[model samples]
Target: MTTVTEAVPPAPAKHRDQVATSLPPARGQSFLKLVTLELRKSVDTRSGRVLIAAILLLAVAAVGWQLTHLPRGTINFDGFLAAATSGPVMILPVIGVMAMTSEWTQRTALTTFTLSPRRIRVQLAKFVSAIVLGAVVTTGVVVLALAGTALGGATSGRATSYAGMGGEIAAGYLTVALNVVMAAAFGAVIAQTAVAILVFYIAPTAWRLAGPELFKDNANWLDVFGALGRIAERDLHGMLPETLTAIGVWIVLPTLVGLWASSRREVK
Candidate 1:
């Protein structure tokens, strides 16, 4: 009995650090945190910084150009807002394109996807960040335009109109924001910065130019720019169906395709 009583040793317990490392993190990545990271990444690069600086400078230049060229009587808050918004709206889509495409172009997709395996969440963060950037740029443009309007009015003794301008400006902001988001979707689908940017600008312009000749009476329904134009003119109520159709074709379809592609595409 004594010879058979050999004691067994206890297994060594894993240290707390080893246990922690063995498991996934206790907290999952947060939406707000992802959005914040995306936003920061948007402008952290040299090109990103340049694009941002160019946007601000262009907005200022546009306001100044309008002041010098337009008659003082013609310079109003609404007009200023429109002109200032044009600068950023023209270029913000490129920023959107770069935002999504850079993940692959810069070879960071592997790291990004690895950290967050749910690619849709990453896509959503990029989309939300683009919207946030659009909103901020729009607000800045509006502020600058307001300052310009005040200066012009004070110096020239011209009357400024505040009535019925809010809706128009808001519509412009929304249209611009939608356009940016659409470009981001295009980038997500295309996965190439230059190609996405080119298609985003040229394809729309070409369609607008050729649609009337090619599609005849139905072109407007399929025209992305046309839908956006209706929005810019504050004619959403009148053209709601056509606008929705255009969005379905241009935005919704591409977004769905992009999400599908992103989900299955191998992360290199």
Candidate 2:
């Protein structure tokens, strides 16, 4: 009987350790919290702070420009608002550019992506943060305009007309949002502060100057400022398609590229 018996395998263990269990899903940072963090990061650094201050200073400088150039009683808020935003509009997008590029140049992408493994969410948060900064700067421009309006009125002993310009305000915000978003998109694509800034400024200017030669009136399709300027004038009744086309090319296209680039961008 012993010779006939064969060794049998041990029965399968039924230990609880072998049980397949679902883990509570790993928690992630909230999108709004991500946006808030990005927003803070936008202004937390020394250079960022300086750039923001420079934006407001430019607004004040616009006020001075109005005070000196415009005759008394003609110091309308509409004009002040327009003048206040002109220089800042050019400078404001730089904030968006820096907000994105600084993270790369300063070597903080490692920390940023480590905390938020979903790179797209982080990139998007930064994008939204730049738009939010544009809004904040726009509000500052309004406040400076109102103050300048009062000062101009008092100093000139002239009546100030707000013009109750709703269209202009709306157009201003749209223009600003577009510019900042475009700037951020360029930074995302280029991933360098200086190059992004130069390209963002130069490419548009170059295109504006040279495109007319190559494409004629049709060149306006690729003219970012020309399209945006028309929109800013509240002249979208007939040019909406043209404006959208330009935006699609400059903003939507680059944004897609930037998101793709940022998602794959290597972090050191």
Candidate 3:
């Protein structure tokens, strides 16, 4: 029997499924790293670079316009800075909108959300990046304004008056932050680039024109643009509460909505 029977091969060992030994450390990583990534995104793309160039060009044009058109007596540092900043202020918020909406518009949300599952931090990083970029743009415009001021002063024989300029410069930075971040919040809530920009511009402009007619004085509290105007004028002394209220209504509320919208939006 032993000679006739072939020894059966040992039964193959049953395969067992192995469990994952460890999980990845929660969703969080480095926030600074996230901001750095966002800053790269803002400046790295062709469109982004084009927009930056356009902003600088428009700023230079503004300075040049003032140099050519304005009376020499009025071509002081303050007026030049104000003129130079105007074009950028209008354009800067577009960058904010792009910062918040570009991922959605370009269909990169899936990867972004996948890599950084906590979406709020991602939104915040983009917002911070927009602010930083706005600051850089502002600095550039300030330099142009200064150069123009020097030229204007030399040609016109008017001393570069810095009477209240220190205050105005500080106020200008505040206005830029408020507008850019507010636009970013709007973009985050909408998650669409074109529509967000349209609304961000139209809504405030419409209110600025009509709300004063309809709501009388109460529009001050709801008018972010008006508050920003007051801030730009460095005239918030008597109306700090109302100015803050407007900022709260426009900036803080929209920012909260944007964070929530971004976090919960489907990542398809």
**Candidate number achieving the greatest lDDT relative to the actual structure:** 2
Candidate 1 residue-wise lDDT, 1-268, digit = tens: 4577668865456666676789976799999999999999998999988987888888899899877766745456777787887778889888789888899899999999999988999998998898888788777878888888888777677787666678877897788788988999899999999999988889878988999998897888888988888888877757788899999989888888888887888788
- Clash pairs, candidate 1, are none
- Candidate lDDT scores, in order, read 0.84, 0.88, 0.88
Off by over 4 Å in 3: 1-28
- Better candidate number, 2 or 3, judged by lDDT: 2
* Higher-scoring candidate on TM-score, 1 or 3: 1
Residue 188, candidate 3: C-alpha displacement in angstroms: 0.6
Of 1 and 3, the candidate ahead on lDDT is 3
Q: For candidate 2, list the clashing residue pairs, or say none.
A: none
lDDT of 2 at 126: 89
